[model samples]
Target: MPRNAAQTEIYDALGVGFGPSNLALAIALSEQPERLRTRYLERTRQFGWHRDMLIDDATMQVSFLKDLVTPRNPVSRHSFVAYLHQARRFHSFVNQKTLFPTRIEFHKYLEWAASDFEHLVRYGQTVTEIGAWQDQGAVTAWAVTATGPDGELSTTLTRNLVVATGLTPSLPAGVRTSRRIWHSSSFLSNLRDWQPPDRPRIAVIGAGQSAAEITAHLYKQHEAAEIYSVYSRYGYTQSDDSPYANQVFDPQAVDDFYYADQQTKQSLYRYHANTNYSAVDQDLIEELYRRQYSDTVSGRERLRVVNLAKISQVREIGDKVRIELSSPHLDGPLDVDLAIFATGYRPMDTDGILAPVLSHCDLGEDGRPLIGRDYRIATRPHVTAAIYLQGGTEASHGISSSLLSNTATRAGEIADSLTRTGRAATTLPVSVPQE
Candidate 1:
């Protein structure tokens, strides 16, 4: 079917992804007395944040106070506390006396907040390209091209663009994902598609939170299955959620980190890596240890932790995966029904999507897009359109750049910047020129 020719509209801001970052921005935009013409496009059919990793018993790492708007505006109606009150769970939640909420409950809160601005978001629309709309040799607007689920093409013109596409799942250099091999990002979805054998053996690679969670999940789901956790670390390192260390996620920390030199930034990231990097929750670490000890006491060694080990090679045999383990202690190959690499993710690169507009944006010595303190892309002065990033600015920002801890505050900053720039001046819809 031919795509219906639709007229383009010049928006104050066009958000690329409707995830928590952009969702928070939407709420911030709504709080402004002078409304900005904004539209958010999401590839998924609906709002979901790490749906596949929403493990049943998994709880959030951050406190509930760091919700969609609390850190920015405590009185905002879109806050988690506000949502709980609206859902009649506020009193019950308080009784629990826990800082972190269950992942399922948190997801529900996000959905409830997102429901308020249904009109502002378009689902199942993947943004394929973002081109600059030049007028008199100066880039004045952005031509946002997106394709809907039904193969219908649409383009919108915006004076400002906010890219919050989030992170991409990353695997090791030599490892390739296949039917039997999986990444932790697709754990639940992939598990549903496969039937475990009578004595299934599974291997979870990496030492991050996801790897720990998946190992625990597999152990609980398949009672008879043997689970192998492979990592170079001796054991899972507990994440440092201490009060002082937690300050790295504060809004003020972003300012400090952004103003510091590149050497200082690298040192800061390395020093605070445990705050968000390859570390597991202390409670979870204890829980897994308890399970491991219990198995030893009962003389049933179903759970094996292959510490100080590296995967030399991974090959698919007839019906199973052969993972060659290389370590000073172990000597042979470990065959498993499935091998899961919970190796974490890399930031979303804007180079491919923003190919048309990259020339106008400044790059640092590292060849990364230069991001300002306001999270806006440092484009040439003539290119008036603002290009802000919600993620992928860890180098310029701080450890909290991709974390939910500073999401509310970050969005508020972007909203303030947009308002100051006065990009919302043109409120009328316009037609896009054919390429």
Candidate 2:
């Protein structure tokens, strides 16, 4: 951990995570007239956006024009186009004439943008708890406690809190990860460290994009290995990226979803679940199908697609894993060297971190936080300090809440709300620490 100053200063706004969402917020705050004393805490040692799953050939699902700042402020210096221009690849990138860039390139672009806000971000710190400060029976501010890299404790006071801790990786119920079991979020890193046998048999579970990509990658990387793709679906479904379907992720759609009734919100999610749910790219789906078809023709089947199947149980044997397959066509248990669950992620629930201060805020009938259109939590009138959320508002904000699609626009909206509410100005006496 870096040397710290006397822990007396209070910031106007403090962000919990420094991912693309909050990084966009930091940039949005920079554009404000009054310099909002801001700080961001990140658990990782450095900036990285989905580093483990950044496969070589995998490209972003969103267009390049919908980058960190273009949707909100096209002239911002932190846009992807700006990064490409700074790297002397603008003309070359334009010559390629592709709407989507490779995942690795987008990660690099995020890192480049994060470098400009190094002074406002503190790495290697994990926020443990957030407590509210009361004055005259009203909550006035918040105290954020975080654990440093060396196990030291520190607290920062702030008038506004923005929780952007990002999504949490999820696995099946009653299933725990071990040396032989893994999740797709850590796929590349874990594969690099594991020592597999001669003919390793691996099973990747799920029908999502990550599952297909991992199955393809394992087949290409481990030539002597057998790969099994287990999913309950009949086959991998192509994602709905058509023009009409893509409108659900538009900025105006957010307003529609936010203002709609509860029943309408439920219907909207059910109707457009294919846009971002367990679906794969058309090209990747065809590629995997072609490989499977060619293997069948050559009588050398290395990739096995186990569709209409569900994993009943996973037991650890001597040196392998016994995965019980349950379906109309299957019978006994199948043994594999390793099992990878590409099960998708869930939003970071605020109930845990905000437990101590939850009583001050209002919740809906479903027991979820009541988030306003501006992304601020609807707390009691006495609680003056603003508690904003950068993610975890999919129910109210729409599907783009946890994605990079509306990140820049969302951040700008939060910044504008804070500025208009007169919460951007700080009364702290000390100056911001220099990087």
Candidate 3:
């Protein structure tokens, strides 16, 4: 194992998760080295985003223009087009005028972006906690705890922290992931461990893109397996991400959503949440519909979609799993062998890590972090340095907080804010030695 820390303290104005969001932040920081000290931490030993679902033909929901650094810095060398060129795919990409790239290709592009600033990122490191402190009336520093590859523990001190740790996959209330039951995030790996049964019956819960994709993937991979899909929606709804409506996800939308009244925010969420979250891609929806039709015409109706149903009980029964699904359409309950949940994920809380220094940070009535326009944490009167945020901005910044739409602009704006804040004065320096 390598050494966990160096002799000197490493002071960072920003620490990020090294994904596309933070990758954009890193790219911006690289351009303005004189103003920012940024470090990106990745738990995986490498950079990858949604690798498990890098299905063979799956394409990005959004256009390629919404890449890591294009909207804010189109001429950037770190742009997706630049990445494609580096990988020798630019010529082929131009031949196909489609702005949406395949999942596999996009994953490769992300890895390429991650490799550019290899020195600014620390792989095989997981941030375990974040603690804040006050110095001369403003939030000055944050102590970040991380575990190294060989289980060694270390802490890094920084003036600003951007938590882009990503979402936490959630299963139905009573269902838990096991060898038999799996979430879509771990679908590919788990499937590799099992030999296809002669007459396997797999139950996928959810009507969203992930759920539908899993249902389709399983149906195509397993010949004799009966795929049962359960969801509350009557049928999969195609996302309304058409040109006119997609502008709702623009960087300016964040400002509009943030300043709006409580009722307006809730109204916007109700109207547009499906654009990014609950709805399936239009092409995917049509493909699934076509497959269902083909199955019906052939009298092999193994691919089933049990709409408006909910999974009530899930239990692992030896090699096979049994699940009980409930719905208004069903008389009692439907049973299945294995259940795969494509429900979704929730945000991670930094509040516990911030507890020891809680008095330094402010909170809103909803118990969420009180975030400002530039995605800075509203600190208590006693704190001074800036505390940047890259996650959990949904409530304050709107739906695009966790999505890739506003990433380029958001990261640049945050970097600009950090530069404007200037150096913090302190009685003692709190920095993590260079690793």
Tens digits of per-residue lDDT, candidate 3, 214-293, equal 88888788889888878888999988988767978899899899999989999998889878777888888888889888
User: Model 1 off-target regions past 4 Å?
Assistant: 1-6, 424-435
Give the per-residue lDDT digits (tens) of candidate 2, residues 37-106.
8899999999999888998799999998888889999898889998999999999999999999999999
The residue-level lDDT of candidate 1 at 203 comes to 90
RMSD of 1: 2.2
Root mean square deviation (Cα) for candidate 3: 3.2
**Where's the lowest-lDDT run of ten residues in candidate 2?**
424-433
RMSD per candidate (Å) reads: 2.2, 3.3, 3.2
* Model 1 agreement with the true structure over 81-197: per-residue lDDT tens digits: 988998999999999999899999999999999999899999999999998877777777888999999998888778899999999999888889999999999989999998888
Instruction: Sum up the clashes in candidate 3.
Output: 10
Better of 1 and 2 by lDDT: 1
For each candidate, the alpha-carbon lDDT, in order, equals 0.89, 0.88, 0.78
Count of clashes in candidate 2: 0
Model 2 ranges off by over 4 Å = 1-7, 422-435
TM-score leaderboard ranking: 1, 2, 3
lDDT of 3: 0.78
